[model samples]
Target: MTSAHPAPSNTVNAPGTLAAANEEFWSNSAETIFNEPWVLDFQAKMRAFLEKNIDWLGIVNDRTSATEGAEKKMLDYACGDGFLTRVYHPFFTKCIGIDIAAGMVKKYNEAAIELGLASEKMYAVKGDFSASVLELPKAEDVASTDLSRDEFFNFDFVGVALALHHMEDPETAIVKMVERLKSGGVFLAIDLLNSEGVSESKDEEGNGGNHHHHHQGGHSHGHGHGHSHGTTATGRSGPAGHTISHDHPAFSIELVKDMFDRAGLTDVDIIYSDWKLELPFVTDPGAKLLVARGRKQ
Candidate 1:
């Protein structure tokens, strides 16, 4: 427990859509973005929503109480410092997280260690689903950077939280994430709801990259736009004018359904979260989380 563990430097991206700038932005913003109080409150709301929708999320019972040796596994995409990891912690025997920033990966590992949890039980690897599958890291790189290994495949549950809006292509990202699920596994998306479709798929000036925001200290998950709270988004103190102005509208229900269907998933259903969400992650006003779920049959 006393051993000093360094963040793994081996980074892997699916190959195509992840922008290098955004990746670097997130890496730089990782330190303090997820640390705000409002951000934590927002997270609590999101957690409550997940717990409320436990059955729909495919878990046997809420992990908050009633301990069991559940062997289920989960893949949390854009897992800034392991929010979903904590959310699913009680239900899983193992959980692997993927993020575009190495700094974010370090934060996830640090949090696990702080909780006295073993790395094998809960840990995050630096990678993004938007990369190219063809260029998966070489075999030797699996231990450090490669995400295409046997362990990285076949998750019981897969989720991409608020960060979906940051991807270069949501459709392709969904497909790539679904490929990680085993048969009958569930693929989930928990993001901001914008029935009003995005004017364009461009993510200009919001947190920076991941879940940006104003002055949120909760997980301080600064997508560079940072946490769902805060003046600096997440918590990155970037350049003076480096703020994101929520120009990118959140995902619409129809858009999410179409993505699930196109990815060859079955039994797809979408629901709005009971939490009246807001922030930059930064979040938005009157924001509702659209929780869309599908099973890979």
Candidate 2:
């Protein structure tokens, strides 16, 4: 099968990094990922797609402003600058962002506050979102990190966007995020449409849903602003897009649908749109937005 993000050679990148270094990669690259022009352009397109499909998404769309809501909540898992949560910010009473990268968490809150959103209105926390892996699904599986806190459970929705291909295990990641929802809460996710169709797009994603929210192009530090790496293997020296390479090559509708079904979610529906990504350093195929959602039941 053809790889979704296979880049033509003759490029500059850190070649020896492993998937374990993703946190450091994301931490170091957080500084500029938020404001980079190309990154902003990509996010704008994501916003447009979400807006265009608001009805299909089944989330709030009142544009009520972040300060007004105080009853419901949203979990922005792998939240990078809180894109999905930001779009639904006005409608939800409280929104919490969870990420593996501390810097990404900081950025999510900073951007919200800059837009006049108080910390209580919308906040982000740094946690190992890839938890619940080794241990069986138990009451205490999520107890180690802030993930176990009461404020973390029972959500109106939990949304992940554009970062699934960066996860080490997208399937397990789904199980973890789904456990955080209330009995009837919905799980929303977005990923690339995989230009090669189901068979070619069958490859999994990288670390987990990811901090690659800074990624639309390739991996280095992130978004051309130095936000995607850790420091060599733990830090990036110059303007790079990510600190590491993506282990999970790409995503397809079949793979995601299977994940949702395995997670025991009902009414799963996966859809795609005409939007595409044409960033400077990105050579991966499939630029269209692929959206998927299912209820916890």
Candidate 3:
């Protein structure tokens, strides 16, 4: 029962200053985390996780570019470091990643360039995809006809992975993401859940910022576990290794269903991975993770 994401003693910061504050934290540490060796492993885990959990290739590969015929487009919202974006790049003809953290987006673009993704096919932009607060293409711009024509809303597929737990309002975020999709577009989400099945308590995350997702890795805001679930916890574990805990109440599977239903997504389905994941970076035993998918009507 090792603890996951033990913030390196020298650099743990405060809990999210606010729902939006997590972006600031990630902006400051974006480069450092992008350079971390564990990030590479994390990327691999992301790819494997998606492969094991969904028919990701089939989903992204389903669409074809109107112009190129064989190409498809995707958006990776809240795409920290574009780790997941890079993973899915090979499948889409064009993949655009957006992040609240400008530095993270910059690093994402740099990584894409380094991979020689042909600028037009893969790129990252700095923006808050969670809302339409920012205006694009000023009044004088030729392409600025209707705000509806904004590039932000154009995507064949959208993905939000390991990020919903950090949101100020996961439900609104889900609704807005689905709104960005064209009719029949797909939305995929993967996030951590509060498996304790216990009602949330103020003290659940504990103090001194020992909560999950407020990781020691300098990312500062996430849902990775930092505590123990004990013998009362029902899940089985693999070889003894480090475990991850949650700082905020884990979103229950039911909550996820409700959000999807409220968003009017059809064909919604969710599943919990049967086995526990052991990461090279975090030590604690892990929790059951949920994978969900739906299509916009």
Tens-digit lDDT track for model 2 on 23-71? 5766666786666786777777768767776776666542353345546
Residue 285 error, candidate 1, Å: 4.7
- Report lDDT per candidate: 0.60, 0.60, 0.56
lDDT of 3: 0.56
What's the CA error at residue 243 for candidate 1, in Å? 10
> Comparing candidate 1 with candidate 3, which one achieves the higher lDDT?
1
TM-score of 3: 0.67
TM-score of 2: 0.71
Worst 10 residues of 1 by lDDT: 1-10
Better of 1 and 2 by TM-score: 2
Which structure is stronger by TM-score: 1 or 3? 1
Q: Please give the TM-score that candidate 1 achieves against the real structure.
A: 0.71
Q: What are the runs in model 2 whose C-alpha is more than 4 Å off?
A: 1-19, 61-70, 131-145, 198-247, 284-286
**Total clashing pairs for each candidate:** 57, 37, 18
Q: Give the alpha carbon lDDT tens digit for every residue of 84-122 in model 3.
A: 666666666788777766767777778788778877878
